[model samples]
Target: MLKFENVSKVYEDGFKAVDSVDFEILEGELLVLIGPSGSGKSTTMKMINRMIPHTDGKILIDGEDITKLNAAELRRNIGYVIQQIGLFPHYTIEKNIAIVPELKGWDKKKIKARVSELMEMVGLDPKTYAHRFPKELSGGQQQRVGVARALASNPRVILMDEPFSALDPITKEQLQGELISLHQKLNKTIVFVTHDMDEALKLGDRIAIMKDGSLLQLDTPEKLLHEPAHGFVEDFIGKHRIMQNPDLMPVTDVMNDKPLTSLPKRSPERALSIMRKRQVNTLVIVDENDVLLGIMPAYDLIAKMKEITKIEEIMYPPEPFLSASATAKDAILVMDDAPHGIIPIVDENKKVIGVVTRGSLLSALSTLWIETEESE
Candidate 1:
């Protein structure tokens, strides 16, 4: 656990960048620090590893004071990624990832294995890119290398300072999805700094809102959206932002109850006909009780209609689905990882309650925009 007890940073010229900030981040939590420029979010995050020493109060990690620890040793164990990526221009990808392990005197074989594992973890093929210099890769790939390098030493905590702000929208979105997947798999303690509230809501386990160097509010995304404590908090987050983002609402609100479905016994030809009539690319295959069996794609059914006997034969397992009680935010986060474009919202008995599609979710989320446009 990490805690800030009355933490404040007063510059030499007597400017207070942080004022009596107090919050604790639980282990394995991803906490986001966000505010306008000069709000001191960056300074607060940097103080975690003593990159910026606090002028007043204490910062503790696992109940030990960070100020008491050696700054070099403290930073070595805590991974940090920045907007610029900060890869050494001349260093190869393998060498870059191996830096921390080498500093601790790991043998070449161990470092090599660790580097290879991290490379694959970040979705880079080690054999293809290990020897390439930082300049050889695109902005996104270099950022991936930076992430791998940060994780090379197996740090329990990571600090990301606007890590994806430099990438193109497509790459940024893709990386955001990948980061969510990585967080779930690794469960690392992460402190991310970003000015984007939407990014904060999507990534943060909890968000810390700051203004004028003072911590205004710290709460979960749902709580922050629904219960903005201070007037500044509400204004900074935008009062109407919640209405614009339906992912903060219940999954049922964003899902369609009447999704196209097919029985496992239904012939592929019959399923294809239904797909054509409905103008959908996929169908949920259900049993006699309306319980989810699997999903059938139009392309698969079309390819196997003559070769397959039943829709079930061409259906893929619905491993990634949501319970009816799940929040829309849960569906949004996992949507990118779902193999099928559609996610079945199921009841406790495994009966399909509704389905959340890309279209359904987008339409529900964009309702405010559509209304605004119509009003204009």
Candidate 2:
């Protein structure tokens, strides 16, 4: 919904903060702008709400030039949140959250309802905390109040400038999760600025990597991980790295879809034949609808060959399996110190679709390291 067209911001002293950066912020998408401290991510974000005016190029929202609109009116339509959690200490939480709505000339009843609703939405109990001053709340709580204040007018676009940077690690993580959940529910176009690559990968729909006031790369987290655009991009990613957060990497991204399988109703002889043909030690047992039942190890099948007829008789319950949406880090956690070398990937109906092996995980990691080294 927001578009930056060859936007550049050069100070009178001739230092360029942003240099001809162009990108579109899709509706309902969280677009994260990440880079080093001097990379102009914050400056790019400020240009959106006209907090910092651009020297050149046009910023359009739904095709209308933002420069043409009054600065206050433009800001009113776009919610802004900063790292400092700037809430007026003297103002009660309710009053802080109601600032925008009150300015828009909302009635007392409507403003009160909005304040209470927003407080509850951000996980603060309106009845208990609404009348409290900002000084009474913790840092995280104050940040939530800031977010509630930003959303007070129900703006279509939100610009968050390192909003979670000041909080402790645990609190930062909690707020990040809340922001992702809120994005999914509210579907507002968000332009987020962060120097932390991990935060960008975790939260962004598309991460824009910037350097020296220029756009370096912009892509989804998965693509960005697998294929960085330049040496600087690779080094930036390598420093923090995607492998460190495998939980953010989807199982589907690194799965063997054509895993060996057998039906539960199949005879032990048939199951053995399938395993031998596939050169696998174990066979995944599934029903006619491909729903995963369990697994049959070669030794288990061999020991019960004479006594058992159906594969189900010798099949042991499958160890923990992952959904298609599960992450590699999740698989690692499930497989840690476990006997199973592979984890079955299932769908919503428990149908076996793929398998991710420890070997695959190692290979993925090795490949990343190799790429990072090559980039250096």
Candidate 3:
């Protein structure tokens, strides 16, 4: 656990970058520190590793006073990822990831194995990327290597300072998903700092909202959204909440309860009539209970109307279904793997509630974009 007690940072220039702040980061939790520029979010995080000395208060890592720990030794045990990536331009990917383990004096063979494992873990095959320089990879790939190097030592705690902020929106979302997956599998305690509230909401277990160097609130993302502690909290989250709405959108809002064209059995004539009458491209297959079984495209019907005997034989399961409450952003992310541009929304009983299509999500996103622009 990491504990901050009355932590305050006052620069030598007599500016109070951080007020007396207090918080405890539980083990295996991803805590996000977020606020506007110069809100002291970064200052609080930097103090933990003594990258910047605090003027007042103490920080304890696992109950040990960080002030007393050797700076070099403490940093080695804590993984750090920054927006700059900071990869050694001269070093190969293999050498970059192996830096810490080498310092720990692991044998060459062990280091090689560890580096290979890290490389593969970060989706970089050793044979392909291990020898490549930082400049050889794309921006996203370089960031991936940066993350791989950070985790090279398997540190229990990680500090991410807007690690994905530099990437394009699509790349940022991809990296965020990757990071979430990695965190789930690894269960590392991560303290992430970001100016983006949506990023914090999607990634953080708990979010700390700061303003003018003072922490306004620290709570779960859901709580932060539904129950803002003050006007400032409300304004900040409310403004950015829509960008993260795709992840929070409920499946019930988009699923089709009485699908215009649904199939119950293998009757080509009936299916053809429904498809032609409704002028729909796809038909949902359901059992007697109205449970979604699969979907059959109208094109498939045109080709196999006479050949196929049963809907089950021709129908293929939809890519994947999501809960109504899931944000559209998450659905879109899932759609990256499924270019179909539609996601089935299921209820608690696993019954189809509605369908959120690319068009529907985009419509909702457009409103958010307009509203956000107006607010700014």
Candidate 4:
């Protein structure tokens, strides 16, 4: 848990790198700070570890003022990763990862076990790569070694400053996925710095957008996309609109809560009456708890009125549905290939809560374009 209260940073030359920015990083949450060059994202991350002293305000970690703590002792407990990786060239991978543990006066046996465990944790084979020098590894491999070194001491907080910016796109994506998986497993509080909006959206639990050395907006990716705080926020997001990642937008934000429905045990005549009243040809059959049972079409009900008495007897199985947490893009893809006109949205218990149709998808797309135009 880290809190920045009215934090500001200014150089002796009168240049303000960060201007009274305030935010909190919750325990086990990955918070991303993103902005263009010189927007103070890197400076803000540096302030956490005291790499750059702030001009005013306070930074508290776990309820203690960092300014009162010894800088060296404080840094040892905080893992720091940078773009250049900064691994010693002469040191072997094993030695590199053991730097922090060795400094803390850990036993040789403990340090060796920690080195091997970390190498394996970051996807490097300990037996094969532990003894090798940093020069023997590729850029991506070196970056992974940097990450292993960061976690070598088992720190509670990790500050990553554009750590993956130098890697190729494919490797960057792979490392991002690895970091996400690692975060979920380790539950370490992380402060990530990036200029890439796509990276921020894909990885951050919440994103903090900065501009001109000031915090602009901070929110989840879904809220940030649908409801930008200002024109600058809208324009910044609009630049990446062409490559909008659907995973950032949940289906619940776009789903229709009201859908035509009928009781599973209802008479065919009653089902038909409900469908006609709603002006829909299809009816979803559900139990009292709204658990999806099947579907009934008006045509089928009308044709089988004389043959079947209950809707359940004439109802057919509904098409595949998605959970409420699924992304809007996933719904669009499912709807594009679906045989039925509507897709049911369900909860964890498989209770139908909403519906997504072609019309809804079109409306969402139209809104997106309209926002883009307004931003431009």
Candidate 5:
């Protein structure tokens, strides 16, 4: 747990990067700090690990004032990752990841084991990537090494400043997925800084939107989207709130209308063909009436090749179907647990109307933001 009390920061040049921001982060919660550049989001994060000292007020970690702790020791207990990744160019990925543990005076065997464990934890195969240098790895791969290094010492808290910003959108999403999965397992208290509203909404347990070096609002993504504190907050969120909320809108209203490739009865070969062709992970399962049946995920199909021969064999019931009349928020929740990135939308008659994929929702959100910005 972490707490900031009346925290503020003013550079010697007299620019305030943060202003009396106060908040508490619970254990295992992910708190997102989001705002435009120079909004003090980064300054706020730095104070947690004492990377930047607070100009005023006090910061406490687990009830102890962080200012009282030695900076090096305090930071050792906190994991930090940044957009630049900051891995040593000359060091192999394993060596880079082992830096923290080594600094902590861990023995060679223990440090190596931890490095291997962390590499795997972040989805990088230790056997393949451990000995590779930073320059040899892709941006996303380097970022994973950064993450692995941060956790090398088993820190209870993690600080991330736009950790995914340097990568392509596809890679960024992949890392975000990995981060979410890692959080669910590790449950470390996380403070993340970003300018991306969508990322904040997806990963944050609560979001702190800042402006002019001051805290604007701190609340759940739903609350922040549904009830912005002021015009600035509204403008910041743009008009994407509607698409982010799936409960009020139906899938038909936002679902992709293009004819989708479907598999008659799920077969590993058929599912693989469709997925490979569409570059998708999901296949809609329907009966003669094109009625909603279930969904077969590409991963599941591949993992259970023999069973996939029968649509019913590989088909797992959808999390729960949403009606066309349902809100977009409902759709979001439905898709949250969907592995295939698809959610089924049904008619009142319980017949399948269509499906909403992640791409559709994101596109709708972008358009909504542009439309709202233009209106302004």
Candidate 6:
């Protein structure tokens, strides 16, 4: 967890990069900072690892003031990914990722194993790229290496400063998708800085909009889209945005349209691999045409992992599901019955189209209550 209390950054020239910022980043949450050029979004993120030390107020990591901690050690414990790939060209891909752990004095075997695991997680085959230099890989591949290197030490907090801005559209989209899946699986606290509003909406659990170095509004994506606290926030999000009453909003408005799924015929090992790669605890089972079959919670699959071969044999019936016509109210009512805190949204034909996660449903209901209180 990270907390900022009246934080600000002022240089010798009297220019304030960040001014009186206050927000707490929850553990395992991905918070995005977005604003126009010179908005201090980047500065806000840099202050997390003391990359840009704050001039005033306190920045705490799990209650420990960052200024009191050693800057070098703090940085090594926090992952950082920048727009430009920062891998050392002379060092092999494996060595590049192993840098942090090596600096921490990890055993050779442990570092090697961790590097290989991370490479696979980022979609780079360690067997092929481990010994290869950064120059040999393409831009996207190099960027993947950069991500792997940042995640090498398995840091709990990751600071990504417009990391995908430099990539081509196709690769950028791909990396964003991967990052989303990775976040779901790993649940690392991430503070991502992006100039793109669309990127912030898609990636952030909660977004903080900054302007002229001051924190504007910090809220969930739905909260920002539905209720912009400041005129600048509204203008930044665009006037064309739909202004829906949270009480009447359908589950579709807030649900994750892209839910991770798996086939029923996979072996426990194969199924487990998919879950780990996707970074999900529950896997929705679907047929070839993607019709809902059953639900496989990670615990159930693991318990039966050695005993059974096929996951289909142990998958439970997909109950407590949300129909396509379901509203946010319906989701809230049935959430407690969800086996793994996941309610799959199925169409009339029984095809899984999306999912209303516990967190999303709770946020919607909370927003509804808050609005009701203000109206009353």
Query: What overall lDDT goes with each candidate model?
Result: 0.90, 0.88, 0.83, 0.89, 0.83, 0.88
Tell me how far the alpha carbon of residue 82 in candidate 1 is from the true structure, in angstroms, after superposition. 0.4
Q: On residues 1-376, what C-alpha lDDT tens digit does candidate 3 reach at each position?
A: 9999999999788999999999899999999999999999998998888899998988998899998999988898889999999999999989988898888788999889988998888888999999999999999999999898889888999999999999999999999999999999999999999998778988999999999999999998866776788999998888556454655544444344555436567686678777788866667676766677887777777788888766677877866768756756667777666434556676677667777666666776777788878877
**Candidate 4 displacement at residue 319 in angstroms:** 7.7
Q: Across residues 1-376, which tens digit of lDDT does each residue of candidate 1 receive?
A: 9999999999999999999999999999999999999999999999999999999999999999998999999999999999999999989999999999999899999999999999999999999999999999999999999999999999999999999999998999899999999999999999999999888988999999999999999998878876889998887887455655656767887899998887899887778888899899989989989999998888777777788898787689986799977777888898998777889999999999889988898887788566646654
Worst 10 residues of 5 by lDDT: 241-250
Candidate 4 residue-wise lDDT, 135-194, digit = tens: 999999999999999998999999999999999999999999999999999999999999
Quick one: best lDDT, which candidate?
A: 1
Q: Which regions of candidate 4 are displaced past 4 Å?
A: 239-243, 252-258, 262-270, 273-279, 285-294, 310-326, 329-341, 346-353, 358-376
The reply for model 6, stretches above 4 Å from the true place, is 241-376
**Residues 121-169 of candidate 5: C-alpha lDDT, one tens digit per residue:** 8888989998989999989889989989888899999999999987999
lDDT, residue 328, model 4: 80
Across 1-376, the per-residue lDDT of candidate 6 in tens digits comes to: 7999999999999999888998899999999999999999998999999888899999999999999999999999999999987889899999999999999999999998999999999999989989999999988899899988889999999999899999899999899999999999999999899998878877989999999999999998777876889999988986333323333356786587888888888899998898899888889999998899989999988887889978999999898887777667678778888878989998999999988888777675666566656654
Clashing pairs in 6: 185-279
> Residue 262 in model 2: shift from native, Å?
9.0
Residue 357's lDDT within candidate 5 is: 84
Of 1 and 3, the candidate ranking higher by lDDT: 1
For each candidate, give its TM-score against the true structure: 0.71, 0.79, 0.69, 0.86, 0.69, 0.67
RMSD of each: 9.1, 4.8, 7.6, 3.4, 12.1, 15.9
Q: Best candidate per TM-score, number?
A: 4
The TM-score-based order of candidates, best leading, equals 4, 2, 1, 5, 3, 6
Estimate the overall C-alpha local distance difference test score of candidate 2.
0.88
lDDT (0-100) at residue 287 of candidate 4?
89
Worst 10-residue lDDT window for candidate 6 reads 239-248
